[model samples]
Target: MIPIDFKGKRLVLFGAGRVARLMFSRFPELNVVAFADNDSAKHGTFVGKVPVVQPEALRHLEYDLVVISTGWWESITAQLQALGVAPSRIVLPPKNMLAINNGEKPFSHAPTKALALEVLGCVADFSARHAIPIMLDFGTLLGAVRDGDLIPWDDDIDFSLNDHAYPLFVNHLADLKVALPKPAGCDLDMTVLEAEDLITGVAVTYRNAVGCNAIVPFEIGFMRRVIENGQSVTKGAGPSFIAPEVHFHNVGSITFLGKQFCTPDDALGYLSYVYGDWKTPRQDVTLAEYPMQESEYLETSRTLV
Candidate 1:
């Protein structure tokens, strides 16, 4: 990704919709030139005081980059390209349609005991290499193993880095796979997160696809959030800690391989946020076991490479 030098550069964005508002609200530091949309009604409208313009008006100003901020990637990309915007100068937000189109769904399996341990190994290696802080977050905090069997859960291994360590992690991610998520099609999957410190960093999540008899894979992306003010903080504004909800009626069957897989309710709440609006059996446990011994600011020592 090219470094955004917004010092005096103009950022012309297309489609002043929800996604655009999300980006504009999150990153107010950038110099926004204006909004461009095909709808004639919005031509003279203003999005947060940034004037909306017709695409024809774009030629009047020299813009550093044209951002396709619309969620409808296919349509927006086509529109921007039709305006003769050089493909190289057109940038889409991370995890936009282009990025999703670039990769395939991961495969699913009964994760091994070694899986979580492998993440731990990666964290140890990453910490040694970077000499930075990384925390074993959320589900990964559940102890390494209990009672002779690996905790069989669909969750992915996750870890966090301070803003400073993020770039180094991204730059060397390929070489450090042993300390990071295993080989997937793309080298690194990136998402910008909101943090309490207002410091930006990437939380790495692993993915697996677990649909049998289906031609195209059904993907499950592992989810993780950063630790702030002694608890986990999500992508939402501030002071957000994951509060697990328990649903306990349907146990012993969580719908895996045509049979219900055992997913605890508290686990389900966390997974709900991770996977986005999933319902589980019922509430079993609220406070699931985590790996860290709570310390100052409730930080966990566990990490990923």
Candidate 2:
């Protein structure tokens, strides 16, 4: 066990990569003061929508804890020490927790599939209680039905509700508490964006930006199309699995994060329509567009018969 706990500490994360982004989802209690990276290109960048600064910039800011969010945690710790950051102020995720995924060259926390699923469930509970209908949207939806988990490099959770139900959430949902369980299997919590609006729909970010802990992500969307889909796509009270991709499964459940949540009628087909190459992970890169791949049902049928 890494003896995880971040109470009464204001943190400054070094390296604005996947690890830094995931720190939030894994340890929501952590009070991150700011983010610092050595990359000159990322100096003026933002991780988790938080600004990134150079080492020298640390002198002007205030923080109590420093975490090295990179595979080179060892060297970064020493560098921070040389820069006068106290050893006690520095923290490192357990060595056992550091892991690599696919062809990615970063050492982040092992994938926590459960943590992501639990948060999804919590939102479902919230929606049901408030009578607000919400469905997984965009990358989050694609990853769930396709890979059965969040996309590695993709940071954030996404959801789209029917335009009519949008007001139900807006009028209700005092807040979004990310459902993070205790035990090492997974950790989840909740954090609604400050000052949520109505029309924009609330953007909920559940993925913590790494492998297990999740990617730095924001969950936002709603049904009803705008000119993107050939000007014919307009928002409406949809039955789902109609426009994006045909979800033959019909609205039902799929196991994710150790629990079952409702998915499109044809969750698998919907994924195929959006992301053609759904099996292989895309970590910090893009691939040339290709034809739509077969959905889970089609692939499974081939295996069965």
Candidate 3:
């Protein structure tokens, strides 16, 4: 079920692509006032009976929330922010659109889980062979420790690499790509490595060779140990808080999917810091809604990867 309360609320879907059409068909009760697209070609088009207009049209539309209905939601989020849309008024897509249930524990997308595990196994093997430290992070860690499997609603896998291992991983990207097993009519793509002040990460995707649909893409975040105010802290390239360095150090291993995977030394403590109540199942909550700790580093640095 969608986390948002759509009753009597107006909405603007920020794309006219396949996902937008799916949302329209699945939730006909939504009062979508317009479809906003960046593509000029779609400016005068129609998604079903809803008019597709320029993103600028959002200024004239009276809506309660803007639903980003495309895979490129990150960029669209920035666009919405530039247009002065409040963060609380933006709704991201659910973990798995097609598999969403009425707030129950939905089944994991079979193909997605299979493909993600395969990729994770290959990456883990490569990391072991090269002696580069990488640990299951974020939702992946939560799933591994709490459920002994991937979170049913999670769409991707996550791992974290320290400063030392990040350089090695980047240097051996080509070899890693070659080592990963590919699905039928698909090739592994490990070329995309992103590094920004706010976040540093790598994405592993599948490049379809034929008409094969793309599989799941996993992320690897780069975490750094920095000194602030005479104390050591751990900070990721993403929204992760500047946490005490002790929790992340001396990495340990745990069984995930029946295989040993690296994790934070004090995994439970780390989870507590990031998720106030890590044991409960709550699919409707977003990262922004998680409990926050005061960080002297950045005013907004209280969430997780």
- 60-142, model 3: which lDDT tens digit per residue? 77889898775455667888989888888888656444222223232265665677677678767887888877788777889
User: How does candidate 3 fare on TM-score?
Assistant: 0.63
Off by over 4 Å in 1: 1-8, 96-305
TM-score-based ranking, best first? 3, 2, 1
User: Model 3, 246: alpha-carbon shift in Å?
Assistant: 2.1
lDDT (tens digit, per residue) of candidate 1 on 1-305: 22344446688888776556656765667678898877688898998899888877776767877777644445556677777777776765543111221222121233323344444565555655665444433333232211122233323444444334455555665555544555333233334343343323444544334432222111112223344454443323211334332222222112222222223345435454543433332211211122122222221222344
User: Runs in model 3 with CA error above 4 Å?
Assistant: 1-9, 12-60, 66-107, 195-199, 207-210, 213-242, 290-305
Q: Compute the lDDT of residue 301 as modeled in candidate 2.
A: 10
Model 3 CA lDDT for position 45 = 86
The numbered model that scores best in lDDT is 3
Highest TM-score: give the candidate number. 3
TM-score per model over all chains: 0.34, 0.41, 0.63
- Which parts of model 2 are misplaced by more than 4 Å? 1-115, 175-198, 205-253, 285-305
* Residue 239, candidate 1: C-alpha displacement in angstroms: 32
lDDT by candidate, in order shown: 0.45, 0.51, 0.65
